[model samples]
Target chain A: MVRFENVGMRYGLGPEVLRDISFHLQPGSFHFLTGPTGAGKSSLLKLLALSHRPSRGLITLFNKEVSSLARDDLPAMRRKIGVVFQDFRLLDHLSALENVALPLKIAGAKNSQIYQHVAELLEWVGLGRQVDAKPPTLSGGEKQRVAIARAVINRPQLLIADEPTGSMDAEMGLRLMYLFQELNKIGTTVVVATHDLGLIKRFGNPVMFLKDGMLTTRKQDELPSQFSRDGG
Target chain B: MMQIIGKSAELQLEKDVSTRYLPVVIAAMIFLAALAIGGLFSLSNAISDWSATLTGNLTVEIAFDPTADLDKKVTDAVELLSKTPGVAAARAIEQEETLKLLEPFLGRNAALGDLPIPRLIEVIIDEDSAIDLAALNEKLGEAVAGARLDIHRPWLDKMVLLGRSVQILAAAIMLLIGAVTVIIVIFAVRTGLIMHAEVIQVLHLIGARDQYIAEQFQNYFARLSFLGALPGLIVAIIVMFIFNFLVGSLEASMLPPLSLGVEGIIALLLLPLMVALLTRFTVRRVVLGSLERMM
Candidate 1:
């Protein structure tokens, strides 16, 4: 669960990139965050991820005030939330299996347990045959799957993905969305930041839309009838 | 805590695909540092030994004793020297003993045969002795025939100056080594940071703590330095041994052979520990410095 109220963020002396943003997500809920480029979507996710402090207002995760948390305590807080980066960000020298096993290892899981779970997840993501391959050698879609697997490997309570389906084909993108749906069904709260309107329409989740630095929330049923006509 | 650091370090190290030779570079740096430190240690020890040998003793020679009562005058001089405040013991060298000492200078078979050598009296001083050379010389003038006092002042001055010079040189070499260590560690840490910049950025974006990120680099550098120090220590010991043997054979009064007693060995053992500490400190500082910039 995450809550942001009147949150504003800026880089140094620059003008605010995210302003007057407000949202709350309950446990096990899924939401789609839709925005155009430079709409402050990434900045908002960064605040929710607890990576950057809000210059104004309150941001809370799992009912704890994150702005008051010490820097050293951030890692343990991060362990409860998993993130799939737009760039994938898999370590190039690490094998796919290692990259996927990273969060569990960071959380001090036993080697045998990590290997077993990572293997099962890689198989589910259709990367079982490329488990030993490094990121540099993997196709864009394969790398995206690997990143997704890594993010969800810990079965985190909150999952945040930025452009999770950007590099994948329609089939792969839909499968990835199904994977996220299954995670939400199992009680993991999911929030995805994407500009892919077709995916959002097909998924039919409550959508949080941002323009410039402001946010507005709309239920799927309340979407304008012409929402389906929006271009990707 | 250690497990977290180890895992994080492994991830960081694995992330840099181009730094396959990092271990080798660290080892080489450590090796060179150890060699420099070991050489300084040996040189300082030798200087200490040389200074100790020259500090307390004096020599007296009766170069010309034409009178038949030379033995009586020698007895009188012995009495005078024994009464002197600084002279603990005085003994006259016999003819045969003097010949044995000169035998090396003049070859054994070709040393001017049966030559008359000077009558020398070797003097040993007590540790607490404070002899006034001018006073002792004036006293010896009336007590013995043709008595020539060689207090070894000039040679002692030269030896002390040489010892001090070596110590200074050794210190300068150590300072140079420390500077090089700092430079190398900074360069290596920076290179690693640059190589893993994406991973670092991702970690930062994901809310990984600064300490967590720094631990990754600190662990890598500590291991690299540890690995480097071993070979440096090995090479230093070997070179020390070879130098010791070479100096021993030369028998140069100016250069004492390298002698590592129990204390010396203990000091050498501590060298690796110093290197490890240096690396840990340097790596930690560099990593923390880089993190400060990130903030």
Candidate 2:
């Protein structure tokens, strides 16, 4: 679960990129965050991920006020959540399987256990043949799938994805969304930020729309046909 | 602790492309650095022992007054030297022994029966004796007038000063070498961090602790420095032994021969360990500092 109350963020002396944002998500909830270009979707996801502190306002995750958490304690909280970066952010020097197994490894999982889970996840993502390949050798879609596998490898309580399907084709994008849905059904809270409205419409979830640094919450049914087909 | 080991292993795997060569390099550096420091220490110690053996005993030379009774003057000087406080033993040097002392510089056949060499008395001081030169000089001067007593103070002082200077110079050189090692390790760690920025970012994003990340680099650098320093140390030791043998063969009375005894060898043995410890501290500090800045 996550709650942000009147949150505001800026990079150094720059103007506020996210202003007066407020939202709350119940445990096990699924939502789609839709926004135009430069609408601060990534910034919001960063806040939820505990990567950057909010410049102002209260931000809570798992019922604990994150703004009050110590820096040393932040990692423990972050370990319970998973993030899929738009850039995939796979270590180019590491193999695809190694990249996916990173979270488990950081969590101090046993090698045998990690290998087993990672192998199954890579196979599930259809990367079994390319498990030993580095990111430079893998295609964008394959990398994205690797990133997704890494995100879910730890079975995190909360999953945050920023443009999870942005670099993939229509089929791959749909299949990735199906993965998120499956995760949500298994009690993992999923919050996905994407510009693709077609995928959002195909699998409707509660929507949070952002424009010009402001967010407006709306039920999935409230989106107009055109906007629902292709996010604004 | 187990978790840290696991994480380190994972990181090593992740950085296999570069880290594969790092351990061998580190081991070799450690060995060389140890060997070099050991050799330097051994040389310094040998110089110290050689200087000590030469200057440890005081020498008293009695110049015979030709006008006086030579045997009587010799007997009186010996009696006075023996009674002086801190005089372990004083005896007149035999004619043959005196000639032997001069053989090295004057050559075996340079001196003949015609040359007049001053009769000298050799004084050996006890290890615990504290020779009072002013008192001994007054007593010996009065006992046999015009019979000068050479305590070898001027030359002894010079040797002591020279020995001390060598020690200080060696220490300064070691300090400079340590500073250079620190600088080199810092640069290496910084370059490694920069080259692996993406990997670091990914690791950080996945909730890896900064200490965990730093340990990986620390281990890598500790290994590399230790390896590189090993060969350098070995070569230094070899050079030191060779110098010791050459100096020993020369057998110069003014310059004592070098010796690597038990104490000297012990000090040399500690060199590699010291180098390894130094490398560990330097690399760890640099890696942690760089990681903190990167974060």
Candidate 3:
């Protein structure tokens, strides 16, 4: 669950990049965040993932205000959530299996449990044969899948992917979306940001549209397409 | 069977490529440090041996007198020393032996028989004796005219002070070398951190503890320090043995043998271990400090 009220953010001495943003997400909910380039969508997701401190406003996560949490306490809170970066920030020195096993190791899972769960998950993600391959040797789509596997390996309660399939073909993007959708079906809250309108129609998750740092919902009456839906 | 296990210590992000230079830096620092410490210990032991000899001895010199018989005067001084309460033994140095003692300043074949060299009476005293030098000098003067008592205590004091000063200087140099080692390690760790920053950032984002990340770097540097210091220590000891083999006899006549006793050997053997721990500590601090800046 996340709540942001009047949240504004900026780098030092710069004009505000995200201004007066307020949104709410209930537990076990799914939403698609849509915006054109330079729409501040990534900045907003950063605030949600607790990676950046907002210049002003209240952001609450899991019913507790994030600004009030101590730095030492942030890791435990972060471990509860998963994030997929646009760059698929996999460690190049690590093989695909090691990269996927990172979250479990950080969580102090036993070695045997990590091996078993990570192997099974990599096999499920179509990276079964590339488990020993490093990121530099893996294809773009394979790296993306490794990133997704690492993100969800711990079954994080809140899963966020920023441009998860941005570099993939249409079918590959759809297949990755199905992976996220499968995670959602298993009751993991999912939020994905992308510019793909066709994929939006295919998935049919309610869209949260952002332009010039402001968020608005697309209602059924306002939509030109037949799939407009209610949003929470 | 072909899975990559994610042990942070096995992460080669920082250890790769830097191995070529890090060991060389550590080895050079260690070599200088070991040489300084070895010389310091050797000087300290030699000074103690010299001090003990000086503490337990004195000398009586009878000036060469043409009017009086010089041998009789030297004999009288030796007789008096033998009868003295705290005197242990007294013997007159033969003219030939005195000529050999002066060979450094005078030519080996110089005619010393024609020159007016003092007749020397060597005196050994009981270590625990409380003999008063002024009273003993008065008694020796009354026994033989112009017989001078040289107690060696004040000269020993000055020599001891000079030896201490040298030890202090050697210790200061050793400490400077140690500081240089720390700085080198700091620079090395910083470079490694910069090269591996991406891996570290990903690790941090994945919720790894600062200590968990630091262990990877710390273990790497500790092992490097241990291995690097080994060659330096080995080379330094080898140099020591070779130098002694070449000039050992000449040096032994001037001072005690330059040997590392039990304590010195233990300290030498432990140098590499201490270097390892120091490197580990320095690297851990740098890693944590840099991570704290990130936060």
User: Candidate 3 on A1-232: residue-level lDDT in tens?
Assistant: 8899999999788988898988898888889887667778998988878778899999999888988987787777788788898999888878999889998988899999998899999999999988999999988888999999999998888999999889798888989999998999898889999877777777778878877778888742343342233321
DockQ of each: 0.28, 0.44, 0.45
Higher-lDDT candidate of 1 and 2: 1
DockQ value of candidate 1: 0.28
Off by over 4 Å in 2: A92-96, A123-139, A219-232, B1-43, B54-56, B80-88, B95-118, B129-138, B142-149, B241-273, B293-295
The positional error of residue A46 in candidate 2, measured at the CA in angstroms, is 1.9
Place model 1 in a CAPRI quality band. Answer: acceptable
Worst 10 residues of 3 chain B by lDDT: B1-10
Q: Which has the better DockQ: candidate 1, or candidate 2?
A: 2
Which is superior by lDDT, 1 or 3?
3
Descending-DockQ candidate ranking? 3, 2, 1
**Every candidate's chain B TM-score:** 0.81, 0.78, 0.82
Query: Each model's RMSD to truth, in Å?
Result: 5.2, 4.4, 4.7
Candidate 1: segments with Cα more than 4 A from true spot: A123-141, A219-232, B1-39, B60-70, B80-89, B93-120, B125-158, B203-216, B223-273, B292-295
Candidate number of the best lDDT: 3
Q: Rank the candidates by TM-score, best first.
A: 3, 2, 1
CA shift of A161, model 3, Å: 0.7
Clashing pairs in 1: B27-B228, B31-B232
TM-score leader: 3
